[model samples]
Target: MGANFNLKTLTVALAALSAASIASAAGLDRSGQDITAFLQDGVYAEAVYTYLDADVSGYDNAYVGADKNAYQQGNKIDDIAESYDFFRYGVKADINDTFSVGVLYDEPFGAAADYSGDNNFVAQGDRDATINAISGGEVKDFASAANIVGKIQDKVENGGTLTAIEQAQLKKLGPAVAVAQADYNMEGEGTNVEVRTENITAILGAKFGENKEFQVYGGPVAQRVQADVKLRGTAYQAANGYTMNINAGQDYGWLAGIAYSKPEIALKAALTYRSEIDHNLNVSEIFPALAGAIPAAATGMNGEIDITTPKSVNFDFQTGINPTMLATAKVRWVPWSDFEIVPPLYNTGSKADPTNGPDGLSLVSYDKDQWLVELGLAKRLTPALAVTGNIGWDSGAGNPVTSLGPIEGYYSAGLGAKYNLTENWAISAGGKYLWFGDAKGQIPNKFAVSNFEDNDGFALGVKLSYQAKQNFN
Candidate 1:
């Protein structure tokens, strides 16, 4: 029975691995080639974990906020999103004196959790009232202008109305109402998504003439992916007028690259480019008991949503400054502008057939393009020990962003060390600190509310490796 249980666990693990590969291929970005190469150098197996925190505050009414609210509040919401963690394991094998292969399992790209509460209400008061009136009322004449007036009248009677004595008072009241409506919309509340990928890469490398100062390698790569997405909170529930279930999918993709290294000058550089993958996801639009409250036309399927992962480029270089010190630098570019996930028929430019989803709403394009830069230095403490530190910066994507994900840029610092345990064994450890910058978006005439705050976090990693007894011939 114990053996059977072990086998069952192994089977489940394999299935999960397969699903992760597919999901990675469909929507993930694999651009940390240098880091992967460092892990593939053989002589050891390593594990690394990373955590990042972002505080996105400020309201400009030019973009979407956590609550899907269109108004802005003077005091931004202090949103604490779900934390991020990743694990990686790798091994290297020599096919001959000049050829070798490496395999790795890790999460290259993933995102989960968004803002919560009625944060958006500070920005989208009018829109929220409009929607509630259309959906909550017995006479659902959404297209009739008279219905809007009736809703306002209802609000006035219910003491939800705004009263002003002069232009200044009216101005203040208008923004206040807008903010309330925005909160009522609450589109991004309790939204969470997770994606993981497992990769297998093969490489053939060769050393050049005399001193073995130069070496080059190239390989073909494949990956699988798995993903899960969930929507919660009052905003989503209120907007749907029904309870909703989590949505999920699985997919796959491939990668390839070549690298060169020189030991004489203590310099190494490599370039890697990953291709994009697409997923034909099977998504479900779950409905809760409140679903019965909305009209049947607004309660069902929004059709198929297409999620296309983005592609990226990575470049890394490192060199020794002297016998006791070394420096390393890296850069990454991602074309987020092309990133889009549109539910079919919803935003197809036709308003007559409202069959796609509520009010023909869609995810549309993200229109983001960004870059990151990193620099590090290492010092040799002894023949068997070394220590290193690094700092990095990420540029912000363009304004008028459309994706639900918040935040602009990040600043990070980290430390790492290596120690020789014995003649054939060694150990490595690393830690990082990340600081997130503020981000702002617009919600029209409503109040502007920041979704998060300026925040920071740390990461820890360790690796163990053993030198082979003899080189394979």
Candidate 2:
């Protein structure tokens, strides 16, 4: 038999490692939806802060002709993945031996990426190139027609009459002038996007069975979400200069879970499920390049964008390997394939165009579900010190994913340490390094726009926690 050691005293030592888990997986997943704070044996509270940074650089595709049958590697895209940070807090208390309540707060989903190099994602601002590209190399003839139409329009607006030749030119120019004007307004910043979501969960747990070893918990969750997007450069072709603003919207969802624990051996296991949340938010969209085809798109349109965040399930388990060591495993699954964001005006304008057909397109979507798993071990080296190590793998949503958030999935390794400040308080810190998978960035119509390879990122986190054990003596 192994040496006799009370494992309950070391339960909180390595738990802080959850704070360092990076969120750069597919489909805007963040926070990992951790609920371990609610599983503590007593009154517990914690505050955690995490920072993540990714280096995602790639090459844009350069295609000639309208058919886009062939392409060559174009300009080098600089690192577009931006560094970001967020916070999490949780507090739980045992109402009695058989009842407990808790509240958890975290930013569960988000994205931050911006393109700034001289790549195709950046604005070229060349009038001739813009017209030539849109007109299939008919710059000379198209410019002449646009000039004639412009002169006649100036005269009419200035209280002057057009010559017979100018009137004929105006009639012949027709839609070309509108197209040219729309192209001229396309000069702006490069492609960029930022999305954010927050979740606050309130839970109530009931313990039952002999010795109260089993528990069932459930609660309501309130979520808030918002986003901003801008599309630029010739890489997007006719859809360049598009922009969207999604106002923040708040909604409600739910979470349910069951847990089993054996305190003598420090064994605890929990399976949690979170329902999907739908947000009907007001959005503003501008797609000037489509003005000639859908005149209403030039000025901009305001409508509702329906976004459904994916449902997810998480499993957390830990058991004592010996008196001074513990082993842990975590598994998570998210149905990213069922998630999508569709802005009303943008989809309508896309459908109105002959190329997009009747069904139109979603602003963003994933091709597959996501699965993640992590395994770890912890060792208490001293009475007040503990260390932990973990390795993880994530199966991304899919390759050829949306350009806005281009990373597929990642492999990661991490290390953490905790030091007790007193019997009831402790501080923990950890860091993780990630190796990202190669991917092809795509747009709504399944068009590959860029390629990313050999990228990596890192994450850092710190947590402070307090706990007071319940007395059964």
TM agreement with the true structure for every prediction? 0.66, 0.90
Q: Mind giving the per-residue lDDT tens digits that candidate 1 earns over 250-325?
A: 4555555555655444566777676666766654443322222223323455445556666677776666566566
TM-score of 2: 0.90
Candidate 1: which stretches are off by over 4 Å?
1-35, 38-44, 53-71, 74-76, 121-189, 195-221, 226-251, 286-304, 345-364, 400-403, 441-453, 467-473
Distance from true location, Cα of 334 in model 1, Å: 1.5
Instruction: Give candidates' CA RMSD values in order.
Output: 12.0, 4.3
Candidate 2, which ten residues in sequence have the lowest lDDT sum?
A: 171-180
**Model 2 misplaced stretches (Cα beyond 4 Å):** 1-5, 66-70, 132-188, 293-296
- Residue range 334-418, candidate 2, lDDT tens digits: 9999998888876875674466778898889999999999988888888788888999999999988998988889999999988
